[model samples]
Structures are given as structure tokens and as C-alpha cells.
Target: MAAKLVTRCSLLMQVLVFFLAVVPDAFALPLNRLKSLTVIEEVNRRGPYLGLITVIESEENAFFATGAFKPHKTHPFVDLSGRRFRVGKIHGEKVIYVRCGVGMVNAAAATQQILDLFDIKGIIHFGIAGNANDSLSIGDVIIPKQFAHTGIWDWVNLYSTTNLSDVVHLDIASYNVPKGEGTNLLGHIGHRNEEFYSELGKPNTAQPLFWAETSKHWLHLAANLENLNSTMNLSDVVHLDIASYNVPKGEGTNLLGHIGHRNAEFYSELGKPNTAQPLFWAETSKHWLHLAANLETSLSNGFPVIVFRGLSDLAGGQSGENAISKFGPLAALNTAKAVVQFIKTLQ
Candidate 1:
């Protein structure tokens, strides 16, 4: 009887040890615990995680604040801006609208912060871009069929020069130039290219004189000429120059310019408050490439990024002074509308 009792006592001790090894300590730190173990603790410590949506813009004029809407009763509007403003939801969807400040630095910072703070699934960068191509006009929208970083060219070029050209070729599919008397006039100008010039007895003397005289009347003539010259093919180059020459004085609407890093210094000299430049002002495709790269990085890291642009100005060699008066407000309104529409679509 004593032996049997002793054996039972030994078994009881072994059972206790086994149970202790299998069970987790209740008093362990919340963060130090493994995910599976801490899930219960997390549930106790905080409520269920919420879905996230982010909206980014360079400026306030590009976006407007509508009052908050709550789709989920439990998750109230959380004001990220220290009570001045609340991060609210769009009507009928699980969305949090945020105003990401201007430039790639601001945009990237804001995006990182939002991701760190919330469980964001996607981000949409809706704002304005100057018309890089003549096919796009003021109020026209661009939804990057492909994205590239204009800034990364040097880095990529260091390894492979060919890669740089390939990137530009991929990122920019087409641009929408403003449609107006300017377009029509420019069309006429294009007809006078080398092909046409050769066909019409190479009217070099007449063409140069006409271009020089028209340059005095039009502020954008110089830039237009530069753009015409830069196009890969002569046909496109000639066509663009001719088009600029023929655009009637009062035909096209203007868009605002948003300054990217490339043209900021030059535009700063214009004495205008540092505002966004229009599409026409953006002479180099480099800025768009920069924007595309930055956004692609964010998107790769589980963030949703969308780029929305309003044709604000004919950026290349055109005066915002002339275009802004006619199209500034309209462009702003159009941009705002696009943002709102994008939000609604999220629903």
C-alpha cells in the first residue's frame, strides 16, 4: 500500500510538470508574446482591426473637405490632426480621407505615416498634372497605364543607359494637349514641316519669318519650338512646331502649373507664390517619372496609390499668366470633382 501511494504521488508530480510546460504565462508582456498567443491579449487590449483607405493631394485647392460620414457605428471618426480635423469616412464605404501635402517628399511621408498608423489596404493619389503631351487638354484626366520615376534615370542610367530611354518609353504612353484654336493653329504649323516644306518648295525663308513674327505675339512660341525640336521623329517635331505657330491668339484655355523639382527653380523666378505648374510648363518628362517611381514604391509596400491630374496649364514654354485667368478656377473645380468621384467609387 505504501509503494502504490508513492507511485501515485510521482505520477501526480509528472502531470503537474507537463501541464506547466504546455501552458503559457498569463503575466507575460503583450508585445513580447507571439502572435498566436497574443491574439487573445490583443482582443482584450484593443478592438478588432479596421479597414483603411487613404487619399493624397499636393494642395488644398486640389481637394475639398466634405463633412464626415460614418459607416460603422463602433469605429468613430478619429481626428488625426489634433482635433482641428477628423479622419472621416466617405458615405457608404469604409474609407478614411487624408490631405497629403504637396511634393513627393510630403506625399511619401504622409503615406508612410498613414500606413504605420492604420491598416491601410490601398491609397489613391488624386491631383493635377500638367499636360505633358498635346493630346491632353485642361481638365483631362491621366490614369497612368504605366508608371516610371523620372528621378531614377540617373541611377538606372549609371548601370544601363538604354534602360533610361526604355523607362520613359514605358511610363508615358500619351498626353492630352488642350483642344482649341491653339490646337488647330498648331495643326496648320505642323503641315509646314520638312515633308510639307520639301513638298512646297522648302519655304524656309517664309517659314522662319512667320515663326519669328508669331513668336513675338505668342509667349509659348519659344517653348513650343523647343518641344517640337525634342520629339524623337522629325515628323512629330515639325507637326508640333507648325501647330504652335497656327494656334489663334485667343483660342485655348489655360491650366495651372504645379512645380516639380526639375522646373521649380526656373518657375520660382516668375515671382508667383510657389503654386503647382500646369502640364504645358512641364517641359521634361522627368518630373512625371519621379512621381511615378515614388508612387510605385509605396504601392509595392502594400499601399494603394492613384494619380489624378487636371490639365492646369500648357506647361512647356507657355505663360500661366495668360492661361490661369481663364482656366484656373475651372481646373480646381474639376480636380475636386474627380477626387469626390473617386471616393464615391470606393463605395
Candidate 2:
């Protein structure tokens, strides 16, 4: 049920045919080749303008499909390496729009190009994110204050009791971090006890369980990059119980919303799982957050970088989870509007 970002995303809409049911004959360029083949000539260009980034064509659902106002002007541009990108002015805002394929590599590549080539003052990556909070419903939007990478930790183990243990180190870590900030947390399974409620809230007894007691070996969290540190109380951390993983699939969603002062696991798992009941609600900023965080740090221009994600699909609310990330027109549309409204306030 996703729409195109108007004409610019028509091809991407086709690329998402696999995600939708009404599959149609569509054309798609290799996501990797979305950029130009070589550096663009530095003709007349401008930035400090707002940068609007999205993933895939469907995510472009907002700015493109809305018939509110067309791009005042569509300027052809490409990365220094030749990757293509679209730029234009709309609603009196100079904006650059790129369907930066999907994944960290593509996103990082595009972000580097934007930082290296443009005079951008801010970057806002807007699109859909899966639900991680019980109070939030479908179509709700979240401008997170903090976000962490999921695969960055070393090991997180759950014990038979309702206790969890985890550890993190700087040695094997792959991402960048401040020096002396390493060796943040340490513990084995059952070190701490905590409860994690389903962000989906209470589930109907008739429905399948969606919330699972998950574990995390958090080496770092970039919810607010302005404050990154490698110091956290090892004893204060919650220990995940073995029940976290033994919970059966289709067990149903958590309906009571009764997760006591259980440690909160607020996070977006990102865009990767291609399965039904895709792990987290599919609306997280995942890779986009990492890229934007790094870019903002490197610039230090007070270049505010924001991420707003709308609920495109319920974590386990779809029909067998096939459409978790597909039917996001509403989320995409709302998020696009959020971007415009936010920039309008700035002006």
C-alpha cells in the first residue's frame, strides 16, 4: 500500500514490488549505483540548506507522493564518486533528497558525500521505524533522544532464572569511540534481574505473544551523540532471564503492559530482517542514526541532526509478518510532513 515519492520514487516503488502484493511491472536501478559515476562539476550549488534523507523508494512515500507542492526546481547532482542524487527547493526550503539504497555501507557512503560536497547546516533522516514503546500506536512518530547499534556488543547471555548478564569491550569493537572510554560494562548471565515489557503493550489472550525478554551487552548508546561515554554501573545493569529467549513464537503479544520497574529496552533494531514479525517495529533509524551521529560529530557546526521515524507496521501485528515494513504510506506521509513543519519553524 506504499506510494511513490511522486515521480522521483516511481522506479523505487517498482523496486518494492516484492514487498507489496499488487506486484506490477517496475524498473529499478541497482541500489548501489544510485549515485553518479563520477564527481559532479561544482557549478552553482548551495546548502546549510536542509538535507532530507530516506531509505528505499517506499520510504520516499512522504515528500514525493504528496501533491501539496512540487519541487520548485529539480537539480541534477551526483556524488564525487559519480553516485546520483536529487536536489530541489520546496516550500521555500532548499532540500536534497536521496533514496540512499539500504544498509550502513550505502548510507555511510552517501552521508560522506553529503558532508564532503555540500555546505549543509543540518541533516534529518526521516522515514518509518518499527514500534518499541507500548504507549505508541501505529502511525505514531518518535524523535528519539538516544539510539544504540544492536550488533556492536560482544556477548549477552540469559540464565534459567529471570536474570541477565552481558559484557562489552573496546578491543573487539568495530565502530569508533573516544579513547579511555572503552571497557564500559562487564558481567555474566544472571548477574542482574530485570523485566522487559512488550513495547506493544498488553496483547489479547487470543493473539500471539510478541514481546520477548531480550538481552543487551551495551558498549555504547548514541541516543544523544553530544554525550557519549564508556562508563556505566556494572552492578546497576539488569540481568536477562533465560525466559527471555525460551519464550515461544506465536506465544502472543504482552497485553498487561505490566512490565514492572523492569529495565527498559527502548531501541530500534533497524532495517534488515526480511521475516514476518520482523524483530523490532520496522521504523527505527538504525544505520541512519550511526551515519548522522558521525557526520554531526565530525562537523561540530551545531549542525543539528535529527531522526524522526513513524510506525509503518506493528512488530507482530501483520498477517504473519509479511507486510511489516511495506504498508507505510501513512507513516511515510506523516514523517515527510513532520520534516516540512520542523524546517518551517526553523525558518
Judged by whole-model lDDT over C-alpha atoms, candidate 2 comes out at 0.45
* Model 1 alpha-carbon miss at residue 113, Å: 1.1
- Candidate 1 structure quality by residue, lDDT tens digits, 19-59: 88866464343333343233333322343222232223333
Can you give the TM-score per candidate against the true fold? 0.43, 0.50
Model 2 Cα lDDT, one tens digit per residue, 153-270: 3343222222224322232232325655753343232211112222233543232222221112111122322121112110111221212221244565444332222322223332
Quote the lDDT for 300 in model 1: 39
Q: Which stretches in model 2 have alpha-carbon errors above 4 Å?
A: 1-45, 68-76, 79-82, 155-302, 316-319, 323-326
Specify the poorest-scoring 10-residue window by lDDT in model 1. 187-196
Compared with the true structure, all predictions reach lDDT values of: 0.38, 0.45
Where in model 1 is the C-alpha error above 4 Å?
A: 1-62, 65-86, 153-290, 320-326
Per-model clash counts, in order, read: 41, 40
Which residue window of length 10 is worst by lDDT in model 2? 228-237
